[model samples]
Target: MANENCEILFDYLRSILYDSTPTQIDVHSLDEDFQKLGMGLQFLDHAINELKQCSTALAKGNLSEFNPSRDNFLCDNLKNIHANLEHLTWQAKQVAKGDYSQHVSYMGDFSNSFNQMTEQLKEREEHLKSEAELEKKHAETVNKYNQLLLELIRQSNDDVLITNIDQSTILYSSHNKVRVEQENEILYYFYKNINNPCEWNMKDKDNRYYHIVTINMEWQDKPSFAHFIHDITQEKKEWDRLHQQAHIDALTQVGNRYYFQDEMQQFLNCKTTATLCYCDLDHLKYVNDNYGHDKGDTYICDFVEILKSNIREDDIIARLGGDEFCILFINGSIDSINQKMEFINEEFSKQVVDYPQSFSYGTIYINGNEDTSLLNILQIADQRMYALKRKRKMTT
Candidate 1:
């Protein structure tokens, strides 16, 4: 359309110029007065009309007639327009081949309307490239974290599992079927009802015990979770071993220091009005002198066994140390205390079974005068034990 319009204007211009043209249409320096110029009044009127139409087009930002041709669309700097089209064509080819880096850039000095448009496309390309790089880095980081998580899963001893707070499955240990199912059941139902320290104990179908500890971790915050369990079989075995150890004397297996002290405290609490019988094997040192310390030790242990067998299960008998021993009478009444004393005397008189070992008896009554604080009471009982020793010496 613009080319046709140009042709039409040029044709009209030729008609007027040929009949009465401005061989030199300089407005000033015309070589002739305005009335003498070619086309005279008729040419002046056409020139004025053409100038007004062009001016109107310029003011409306449409200085040329509308034509769809690419060449006519070049409003300014034809070189810049050419470069822009080449860049756009290259970008299109790259897009077709799946590359996105080609972008339009005109010569810096060629500031034109095309420059603004290409600069905008350049900015958009840079933004997209940056966004793609960020996404790539994020994916790499997530892959690394997942790799580390996979390694950790391999090394764990307890059956580890993860789940949503809503009881949806996330992950679990591979080899442990019975435990995972049991633990999953427990965590599914119990965690919400209890305080958040959500803990439970389970025995798997394998009869293996596990102490499960559940902890909630924040992620997408839709109650994603993790769990750990500890197998307690070895711990249970140690406990049983310790429990057996706790009740027996290391040397004699009668009662350990702990058991003896516990029994003493309980006996004292309940049997207040009781007699404490303190005894020592009579000639233990003489035996150590004649035979070796080994034989003397053997004699003492044998003596303790005899005392234990002779006493009631309710009776707490202990080897105080070396050759000395102690016993408590739950029956603290005078008759009962005396009867226990008589029995010990009778056993002393009768014993010599194989290797002779007899103990001297010392009886102390619970009464108004003795300082009965545990240690003091034992001290008082020992003192009375020595006085009984003196009487034995006289009899011997």
Candidate 2:
């Protein structure tokens, strides 16, 4: 009986070593000495079964399946791993909720990787926040600038127009509704030189002048042009007044000597055909000495009217001094101009009742090929007039 009990005990121990679940021994059938061994093996089997259940649950990722008892120290390490894994899962949930503050420890390489991932996520989150803030600031800046631009456009004296390259459609106009005719005129001028955006001047139907500036620009992300039209009618009038004061004779309303010189120089530069007539009123000194300066002025004005009536619109007449005048005819024959002058002189003599209001004129034809200076031409004309005056004195 003792040998049979020992053999059964040895076989059970061998089965346990082979990782097989040994059959539980009946401790009551064994003798006193063997019974103790039998009970010890039974306890060993229970512990091994507990460990297998815990290990299987862990293998299947079922952490709740096994709870290690205080006496079951064999699964204490697995219990720690399960606790760590549960905490890590909670940390992962927190991270998913945008919390990168959670950290792990004692998890070897996984801990390092988790910490690195959180750190990188935090950096990325901060970067995104910074970009969002920059975008917000940029948006605010753009809005402010847009408001300022709108206010400036509203306050501007110039009529601001934004349009597509097409002439008829106006995308935006700073001013209120414009008259149809005026709008058409503006668009006509605007599109006339759309291909060449530049500053120019145009006159409206009402004879109002405008200084226009066109610039290529974008409106609502579409290619467009901005037209700034400034009403320069009043300015133009003032400029004309100033020009008249500067370049016109106050008495005769003709061009002054300065104006004549400037026009002659410009005409010379053109190198084109023209005729110059230098004239002197026949008895200006005698009229001033006998009938006072007023009649002399009247005499000068009367001769000026004759010259003006005979000349074309583009022809220039300049009062050089008291009674000497210069008349320029662009592209005319010297003989024809001289005849025109002689007729004017004869007409003036016939009209004069109070005094001799006639004039003597010397004309020179310019073919534009000559490189003669204006002073030289005037000197020759002056000498010819004096010679003609001397001959008239001898004949009369």
Candidate 3:
């Protein structure tokens, strides 16, 4: 059985060494040396058995002579086997210790197999190491982008909101929250879904009386994030006040000469059909004399209200100066102006029953044949007003 095993190991060695085989030899044949493995394990067993037999022989005072050639052969084979196995054991330790780059140099030409395995392992190890380094660098790059994105969001002054399109409310800015009214349900909904840089007009729930201008914009590169809101109530009020002041007489709170001038210029420039009715108080100083300057001022204020009530909203009525007033009847014919004047004259006549208020006025139309400028035409109307006042005084 030992002989068969030894022959098997020798065949493996021979196949690698020469890549051929001796098919003619019988493994159990006696001429082919009957040897076990050349490692000292078998040699030790044989040596122990021999020593015992020799001891017993010697005890009987008889012994077999030892052969010098056999002893030399056994020791040489054992030394070769022990040396080769110890070298193989050292190569295995290098491989198992993660030194896949390690090569097992042939101790006596038997290490070629181990060398091939180590070379392949070394190639795989190099690839794995490179892959690991790339992954580490990629992870670091992603972390940096995340940090920059967070920092940008925290630093923005523009109201930014984050929300899902489907969700009723995801997140809103504190700036927006402050402007939200008690009854505002849509504000929350709008904040979530609003696309940025868009204009929207909104009303707060508590303050539906005022309009709030809202601006919305996209907040991030992601679709999940959107922005909203503007509170323009105060701005609108200020705008209206400024607009009023532009065309109003500050003291009397009526339309001023500047407004009348602008409207006349617009009419003339646009070639609009219109008539002008110019009126002047006949004796404003008489009231200042009979009563007081306070009564005179009261009389002027009362007359302004009457003028405002009598004229159509489209008509431009203005105090040209202290005691003179101008009216531009938009698209009115001479007949229309006459009818309106007659009505105002009837009302003014009634004021004489209790109040000392009387006025004289004249009207002019932009007839196709008239080649006069609006300013010159106003001058002509002024002359006509005074002429009528003089005629009325003479008749009274």
Candidate 4:
């Protein structure tokens, strides 16, 4: 009976060590020593079964089932693995929440991989934040510049406007309403030639003049124009006043020598038929020597008034110098000119002055086909006047 019990124990131990299916031992039929051996085999089976359960729990990622204090080697390793895995899981969650400071110390190659992933994530996050800040600053700068530009336009004396190509929509305007009828026409012309800058004069309802300038531009991603209408009413008036002062004689308030030359050149260039009359105050130097320059000036002024009264409005009269004067009559007949000259002489003869207030006069007729220069014509007239003056002096 002892031999049979021994054989059963050996068979069960062999099966437990190397067989796929372990054999069972019957302790009730064995002696006390064999029964003790059977109890030890059962304890080993219980320990292996517990290990299998722990391994299955670990494979399924359940760490609570593993215990290290109960065994050595395999169980202790599993315990350390479970703790490391739990720590790594917590570190992963921290990283996910934007905490790149989390690190693994004891996960071998996985520690290096995790740390590298965190570093890369941190760099990417910082890059994105920097880009976002730059974009925000750019947007703010653009807005500030736009505001300043708007205020400048609003405060300027020059009218500023921004509009689309069709003029259907007005984007911005310095003035609430357009002040001129011609502004719309100018804007239309600007749109037709958008590539070129346009400029023109415009008059407002108050008769004020403005210089309009239109420049092509893009606004809000659409084709548009910026119209600058500068007020030039005062400038125009000032210019006209200056122009008049330049042409007018300061002393006589009539055409000066410069104006006469300019007009004569124009007439000559046009080949206009005209008559030029030259007159010299008979004794201007004598009057100035005896009665002072004031009296001579008065005499000159009186003679000019008489000439202006007797001559037609179309004729140009000019004071060439202190004692010389000239008149240009456009297309005048010689008979009519002679009659006017006689009338002027009679009027001057009636004047009562200490010195002679009379003037010596000569005339030259200019045909449209004449090839004579202005200087030659003036020389002939001057010679005739001097000859007539000499004859008058001798006769007197």
Candidate 5:
């Protein structure tokens, strides 16, 4: 009978090992030795079943479903996996909440992938933070400059006007109350006088001069135009007075040395074809010594008139000093200028028959390609003029 019970116990233990439902054992009916073995088999089967249940829950990602007892030694390895998974779950939650310090060490390949993911996330977040800081600083700088521009616009004497071209209305005006009623007139003036962005001059009905500056701009999210106007009547008058004093000679009412230099520089910069002639009146000192100083003045004026009549309106004639003159013939050929110079000499001799007044002249053809300064050009022309005067003296 003990042998038969022993066979039953072995069969039942084998069934438990293979995870099959084992036949029940009656410990009371067996002998003492057999009963002790049957009881131990029952405990082994129970622990194995507990391990299976816990491990199954873990495989299904259900960590909270099972808690094995301390005596369940078969489930020790499973419990370790469970504890690590639970800690890893908490770490994942921390990572989601922007904490990047969490690490997993013992989960094999899964640990490596998870750590790499966290490191990339941390780097991305730090880069985004830096960009956000830079954007904030840029916004602050733009706003500060905008405020300064507004202050300058407010404090300026210029009449700041912003007009909505599409709406045909004034959007903003520095002199709002004063110029509000003149909206139609202002728009008319802008449409008629202003075609591009430029500084221009206009006169009001009262003959008051105003300097107008216009630019294309945007206002209130719409295409617009900004017109800055200031009364420049006094400014223009002052400038003209100063210009006349600086550039015009008092004696002959023509361009002085300063004006001649400026004009020569402009012509050279433009690189245009032109001709320069330097001339000096003959017997001017003799005329001043014999005839009165008034006659000598009359002689200079008559020569100026004759030169002015012979040249085109665009040509420049300037009295360099007493009895000396320089002329810029715009787009003049050497042949045409030489013929004109001969004619001028003949006319002067006929006009001043009493004192035999004539002139000596030297000419240079400028193709506008000379890499020379105004002073150098003037020196060359002066030497040529002296050479001609010496030749004339020898013949006389």
Candidate 6:
């Protein structure tokens, strides 16, 4: 019976060590020694079960239930594994928070990989920071240039306006000299023709003229317009003064020969009803030779004053040359033009005492014929005037 108990105790111990099957032990029927052996085997089985639970907790990353006894080899190994896992968890959290300096030392190949990852992360972070700084500097430079351009526009005399396509929103304006009525019209026109650039004239509230240039452009990613206005009122006045000097006779303050020809061509083009009267001073050369050139000048002025008094405000008289003159009597009949010429001759005779200030004149009435050129009309009048002058000389 002792042998049987001993064999059962030995089988139970072997099964605990090497097999997964449960062992049956008859401890109540055994002697003292066998009973003590059975109690030890039961304790070892319980310890093995506890060890399995600890191993399962570790596999699942749960360390709460893992308590290692002192000086125990297997438990000590588990404790070390748990400690390493906790430290690694802390390092991973630091790395997640942008601390790329976190490193591992004890995990051999894993430590090398972790350190390499941190180094690459730090390099990428630095590159991104550098890019951010460069972008900031570029933005500041663009802002500075914009400010300078704005200052230049403000200081310049040229009026500038920047607006959206509708012009309901004004983006920028250099000055506020544009009239409200004209401004509205300009915006309406620009909005309708946003693609075309143009130049034109406008008048402000003070009746001053402005030369305006408009261009199509983009502002803030939207279709827009730019208007540049230059005040040209003074320029226009100066141009008018120059034009008058060019077209007017200096001494007589009447139309010069150039003005006479220009008006003749315009009248012919429009088929106007008019009479061309060519006249020559009867004794201008005699007066110039006998009483000096200044007296001849006075004789000419006296003739012009008599001509102006008889003619209407619309009639144009011009000095053709030194001793010749021409008249364009607008809408005048042949009889009315003859009467005017006779009256002028009679009045000038009384004004000049030294030399007879009579003028011989020839008239050609325009009949609105398309074939009649300005040259032909002037030539006919000039020939008749010379014929009259020759007749007068023969009689004297």
- Per-residue alpha-carbon lDDT of model 1 for 153-191, expressed as tens digits? 666666666666565565545344335467656555445
Q: Which numbered prediction scores highest in TM-score against the true structure?
A: 2
* Model 2 alpha-carbon miss at residue 306, Å: 2.3
Q: 1-396 in candidate 5: lDDT tens per residue?
A: 868888888888888888557666787877877888889989998898888889899999999997898989899999899999999999999999999999999899999999999999999999999999998998788789867976777787767777876555778777722255444555577678665678877765656677878898876568898887787878988999999989988878999888898898899999888889998888889989999788888788888888998999999988888998899999679889989999988887887346777888888888777677777777777888889889878996
Determine the C-alpha RMSD for candidate 6 after optimal superposition of all C-alphas.
12.3
Q: In model 6, which runs have C-alpha deviations exceeding 4 angstroms?
A: 1-150, 162-171, 176-197, 202-207, 219-225
TM-score, model 2 to reference = 0.63
Clashing pairs in 4: none
> Candidate 4 regions off by >4 Å?
1-150, 161-172, 176-199, 202-207, 214-226, 368-373
Question: Candidate 5 regions off by >4 Å?
Answer: 1-158, 165-168, 174-209, 212-226, 352-354
TM-scores for all candidates?
A: 0.43, 0.63, 0.45, 0.54, 0.53, 0.56
Runs off by more than 4 Å, candidate 2: 1-135, 165-168, 176-181, 394-396
Residue pairs that clash (backbone atoms under 3 angstroms), model 1: 165-223
* lDDT of each residue in 85-193, candidate 2, tens digit only: 7788889999988999999887999999999999999999999999999989988898899789878877777677777865558888877434557767888866664
- How high is the CA lDDT of each candidate model? 0.61, 0.84, 0.63, 0.80, 0.83, 0.80
Report the alpha-carbon TM-score of model 3 versus the true structure. 0.45
**lDDT for each residue of candidate 3 in 1-396, tens digit (9 for 90 to 100):** 666666665664454344323222233442234433323333444454454444454445342332223564434544454455555666678887777655656464556777877877888788998998998897788779857855665565334444554453545444433444432454563555553435555555554323333433333433454443334567777877997898888767878887777777777777656788888875678888877777777777776777788888888878887888888887668787878777876676677533467788888887544456877979988988888889989999
Against the true structure, candidate 3 has what lDDT?
0.63
**Residue range 1-396, candidate 6, lDDT tens digits:** 789888888888888777765576767778887798888787776566566767788899887777655544546667778898889889988988899989899888989999999899889989999999998897788779878977877777777777876645678777645655666655665565543568877655566777878888776568877888787889988987998888888888888888888888887888768888999888888999999999989888888888888898999999988978998888669988888788778777777386777999999888875569878988999999998888988998
lDDT of 4 by residue, 1-396 (tens): 789877888887777777655777677778887898888876676565566667788899887776544654446667777888888888899999999999887988988998999999999999999999998898789789889987887777777778876663568667733454545654654555553568767665567777878787877668887788888889999998998888887777778888889989989999879889988888888989999999988988899899989888999998887888899998678668867886898889798877766889888898878787889989998998898899999999
Best prediction by lDDT? 2
Give stretches of model 1 more than 4 Å off.
1-154, 159-228, 235-250, 262-276, 328-338, 354-356, 361-373
- Which scores better on TM-score, 1 or 6? 6
Q: Candidate 4: lDDT over CA atoms?
A: 0.80
Model 2 clash tally, residue pairs: 0
Better of 3 and 4 by lDDT: 4
